[model samples]
Target: MRIVIALGGNAMTAPDGGARVEDQLAAIGAAAEPIADLVLAGHEVLLTHGNGPQVGNLLRKNELAATVVPPIPLDWCDASTQATIGVTILDALDDALGARGSDRRTTVLVSRTLVDRDDPGFAHPTKPIGRYLTRDEAEPLIDHGQEFVEIAGRGWRRVVASPEPRECLDAAAADTLLAAGYVVVCSGGGGIPTQRTADGRLEGVEAVIDKDLTAALVAGHIGADLLVIATDVATVIRGYQTPTQQPIGTLTAPAMRELAAREAFAAGSMGPKVEAITRFAERGGIGVITSLDRITDAVTGTAGTRVVPAG
Candidate 1:
């Protein structure tokens, strides 16, 4: 089966603030175990990941490097973060495959996704970016025309417009890699949202694309039979966190629409997952949503919310 798996960011960070590279290597190594099993089991896999924490860490590095060189834009920082993660993950997968006595090849493509220049999301700028800063620290950036919004009432963060993605800029390349029997990891952090200039040159935009939405696009582009979204939760819950919350095992597209209308999922959380699954199912795609540990089972259809089209 051709599958696209979107790994979440929390998988990389521990409870405390430490983010040593070796520790992250160990964490991702644990996460990639089931994935390697899938590869060994003969499923064609394309991996994508979220870089929220990674990019934030890179932004701090940029700030520190300002004394030696000028800090780069957030979009460029995201691109660098993607390369860092893709390289690290590819190395781990290579090591894991070798340790398992398999000779499967894994590759990371520094992917780029195309976004509509006129997307309404550009006007809203809802996706947060950069390092979290104290009010005093954020005030200067705000004064200098950088966008900052208060999150959780503790501090401020940069909010970038998370526009809808139109296409994976490197979809053809990813497909080629997949066809060549390589486990390709592409489209990290929604591929560094980009647009075409009037002269037809692609340029980076100062925003993000919803990673789940991007994953759906990648799945469809690759003709994937399954798109498994690995999150912190084991299953998507309706009326989440409420007294009457219920876990959903399966849902028809229409039923999902009704729940979505009632706002069952939080906007910054599970809402996008539902929307992404809906889009994938509506487009003749199959999908599962589950915790990271349950990923292999989710792919085998024994676990997770198996979202299918409404009959």
Candidate 2:
């Protein structure tokens, strides 16, 4: 089957959110094992990952050196983190495949995703990024037009607009690579949010796009049979964090949409994931939500929350 797997940023970072290069590579190396297994099992795979921690680290560096040099824009930061994480994934997957005695090739395409300039997301920036800061430290940034929201007792965090992705501009390239039997990695950090100018030139926007939503877009564009969204959880829970919490198994697209309409999932966490999978399922593709370790099982229908088209 043609598969598109979206790895969460937490898969590439330490639990405490350390951004050291070696540690991040080690984390990705571990995550690459299951992916390599899928490739060896004869499934064509396309990989994409989140960049929350990495991009946040870059933004922190920019702030530290703002007086010494100009800070990089958010779009550039997205591009930068995509390359950084892409190369690391390429290296790790290469090693994993080699260890399994497969000579399969892997490649990365720094992609662009189109978004509307007038997206309501731009007017309401809700996606949080960067490390938590004390109110005293956040005041200056707030004065400079940056938005911050206090996370209960966790302190303040910078937020950015998470615009919806309209298209993955490099989906053709990814399709070509997949046809050639290459494990393709593209659309990291939601493909560096882009828009068209009045003169028809492509320009990067100062916003982030949700990776799961972009993954669904890319899956449809490339005609993927299966979309796997790998998160830290093994399965989607029906009543998360409560005594009645239970793991969801197989759900029809319409059933999932009904649950979504009722706000059964947390907005910041499982909501986007369930929405993405439902979108894919509505388009006649199977979607799985599971942790990285259970990817093969999820594909085989023995594990994970599987979303299928309603009859």
Candidate 3:
């Protein structure tokens, strides 16, 4: 089966937010094993990952070094993190494949996603980046035209526009790699968030596109049979954290859409994931949501919350 796996950015970093290169490589190394196993089992796979922590770290660095050097734009930060994380993923996956005695290789494509310039998301930045800061520390940025949001006990962090992804500019290249038996990783941090000019030139925008949505787009573009979104949770839970909470198993796209319509998931968390999978399912592809460790099981329908198109 042709599969597309979306790895969460949080999985790329330490639980305590450590961004050390060695630690991240270790994290990705562990994550790469299951993916490598899939490839060894004869399934063609395409991979994409989130960049929340990595890009946030870059943004923080930009702020800290503003006095000594010019800070780069958000789009530049997105590109940088894509390359940084892409290389890390490639290294780890290569090592994992080698340890398993497989000759399959991996590669990364610096992808770009198209978004509308007039997207309402631009006027209202809701995507959070960077570490938490006290209100006093956030005041200076807020006064300088930057947006910050307070997350209850998590303090304040900068927020940016999370526009919807319209198209993936490099999906053809990714598809070609997959066709050549390469475990391809692309569309990191939603493919660097770009838009087109009136003259038809591509321009990077100051926004982030949700990686899950972009994964679905890429899956469709590359004709993937399965779309797997790997998150921290083992399965999607209904009424999460409550006594009535129940783990969902196999569900049809219509059923999942009904639950989503009732706001059964948190918008900032599982909401987008559910939407991404449902969209893919609607298009007649299988979608699964599970933890990184259960990706193989999810593909076989033995684990994870599976979404299929309604009959």
Candidate 4:
């Protein structure tokens, strides 16, 4: 099967793993075990992943470097961070496969995605980024025009506009790898969201496109047989975390839509997963969202929230 898996950021970082290189490599190696299995089973795979923590660290690095060197823009920082993550994951997967006596080749594509210049998300930046700052702590930055939002009881954070993705710019390159029998890892952190300027030049935007949604776009573009999103949940639930929560394992698009309308998922969490699943099913691709360990079973049709087209 030609499958595209979206790896969760939490899976890429060990629970106690601070921002150390050793920890990240070990964490990536562990995460690549199941993924390498898919490749060994002769399944064509495309990989995408989250780089929230990685990008956060990169931003902090840029901030620290500002005292010595000029601070680069956030968009450039995001691109650099994703590239670092992609290379790390690819190397770890390659090494793991070799250790297991497999000869599968892995390639990491530094991907870019096209976004609409007029996307409304820019007008309303909602994606929280950078270091979390208390109100007083952020006052200085805010006074200097640093964009921030107060999360009520959770302190303040810099929020970037998360725009909708239009196209995966590296689609052709990734497709080439797929055709050549390589496990391609691309589109990390939603392909470093970019837009075409009025002068027809593509410029990086200071926003993140939802990773799961970008995964859907890649799946649809490649005519994938299955799209698996490995999040932190075993199953998607209606009224999640509440007493009335309903665990749904198999659902049609229409049903998921109705549940979504009722606000069954939290905006910052399950919302993107459900939305990605709906879009994938709508685009004639099958989808499953579940925890990372359940991925093999989910792909074999045994577990996860299996989503199909609406009747």
Backbone clashes, each candidate: 0, 0, 0, 0
CA deviation > 4 Å runs, candidate 3: 132-157
Tens-digit lDDT track of model 1 for 33-139: 88998999899999999887777777777555644655577678778978888888888889888989999888888878898888898887877776778877666
Candidate 4 residue runs with Cα over 4 Å from true position? 134-145, 150-156
Clashing pairs in 3: none
Please report the TM-score between candidate 4 and the true structure: 0.92
What is candidate 2's lDDT per residue for 1-311, written digit by digit as tens?
99999998768987676879877987899999999999999999999989988888887886566556666778899899888899999999999999999999999999999998789988999888877888876776666567889999899998888888999999999999999989999999889899998889999988888899999999999999999999999999987778988899999999999877865687777988999999999999999999988999998999999999999
**Global lDDT of model 4:** 0.84
lDDT of 3 at 169: 93
Best by lDDT: 2
User: Candidates' TM-scores?
Assistant: 0.92, 0.93, 0.93, 0.92
lDDT of each: 0.83, 0.90, 0.89, 0.84
- Candidate 1 TM-score over all chains jointly: 0.92
Model 1, runs deviating above 4 Å: 15-18, 64-68, 131-136, 139-145, 149-156
lDDT, candidate 3, at 297: 94
